[model samples]
Target: MSGSREWLCYTDGSAKPGTGAPGGWGFVVKPPSGSAGPAREGYGKATGTLAKIMEYRAVAEALEVLPERAQAVVFSDNQSLVESLEKKLESWRASGFRNVDPLVVESVRLIDRAMNDKELVVRFQWVRSHNGNPGNERADQLAAQGAREAKADLAVTTKRR
Candidate 1:
């Protein structure tokens, strides 16, 4: 393991539409080699709200924001999400994600894009949430904040539009 580095990435999403708006997604990346870059954070909003979609979006956003040449291993609390991305993607897509929620498709697209990027080698794993993993906790908080911001921005944007 000497001179080898791995990146630990965590992502989360929130869908609280009770405020009369859709929710958002968020993600945070921590480098195992050492702290690096500006530390990334991102958010995206959608018409309806679902934690799965938001979670998928957050991971996608993180992948996009990560340095192109960096090698990474993403840790998520969602077992289904990880398994789908790491293994079941092709079958799911072929089956039209049958019996699967639309969010699963959206998430797969994001993962595919990330993997197809010219310079990314990503492996995903499942981590237990709220167990006090600092990086995961940070990512979770950032995700919640992103959701709130997205809802607020959506309201503002909708009003203006």
Candidate 2:
């Protein structure tokens, strides 16, 4: 693919109804060719983790799966995540990741990974959640499924013991 082409990616993260619950994140990638690609989702032990972290994880996971040297615009429903990536990333780096209020240091690692990828040109776009956006809705569903799967996996493992 030409480096000039841009891909579109929609990403979302979901946690269960309570704090310290398991959560999941997912992304849907649309290549420049205008064909939708496979969606990616993951489950993790999200106990004590913030939803923002999961949101950032979704973006990072999407970037990781894209082809090297791909240019893409990633759409996210999390305003904080979008703002951090678009506005706060440089300041956070200059501060050496310190003394920042309303900043998530946990997401910095993944954000840094995405930013440092010389092969990828990634931009973030914020979309309203559950606002009848097809991509965002699909991403949300995938994330929920991932969370459920994670819980189920934990249950199975416990039974095995």
Candidate 3:
């Protein structure tokens, strides 16, 4: 809401088989500040034990890929993911991941990178999924795509990681 404008981001993360099987996560960035409505589409996936973290990492990585801007807000359907990324992560990390989700720890590192960037104003908001919101719908599509791709490649990456 400052000078010209900034980016409005929507992101989503998913785990295949409801957290058992490998899954993927993705995010869609809509830059309303510029003439183009969609700034970028980003997706990342990982299989095996780190499936959930991989999805969350995709969001943080997408932000890293965003164009330099003065302001931006990120929206997601996962409240715990948002809260863990924005806060609570530090305490969990300080405790040595004790009772902390590993994915949460990885997300913390990514969020920390953003924190150091002064020009960026990133806010994480929780939105209701499948609510008929276009942005969310788009994000969901991207996420699904990412997950499917990751699942297909899980066998290859599982042993490497």
Q: Which candidate, 2 or 3, has the higher lDDT?
A: 2
lDDT of 2 by residue, 36-120 (tens): 5654444343444456767777887777777777788889999878887888777877887784444356556566666577467
- Ranking under TM-score, best-scoring first? 2, 1, 3
List candidate 3 segments past 4 Å from native: 1-4, 18-20, 34-37, 49-55, 86-100, 154-161
Q: Give the per-residue lDDT of model 1 (tens digit) for 3-79.
A: 24766678877777565446667677766565555556656666467778878877887888677767788878878
Candidate 1, superposed: residue stretches over 4 Å from native: 1-4, 17-21, 35-38, 90-100, 153-161
TM per prediction = 0.77, 0.78, 0.75
Which residue pairs collide in model 2, if any? none
Tell me the lDDT of model 2 at 123: 81
Candidate that would win on TM-score: 2
What C-alpha lDDT do the candidate models reach, one value each?
Answer: 0.72, 0.73, 0.68
Backbone clashes counted, model 3: 0
After superposition on all CA atoms, how large is the RMSD of candidate 1?
A: 3.4
lDDT of 1 at 91: 73
Give lDDT: candidate 3, residue 58: 59
Clashing pairs in 3: none
lDDT of 3 by residue, 1-161 (tens): 65357576788776677433666667777765545654688776655534457556756766786665446677888777778667865576577657566546667666656655645666677789899978778878877887787777765665687
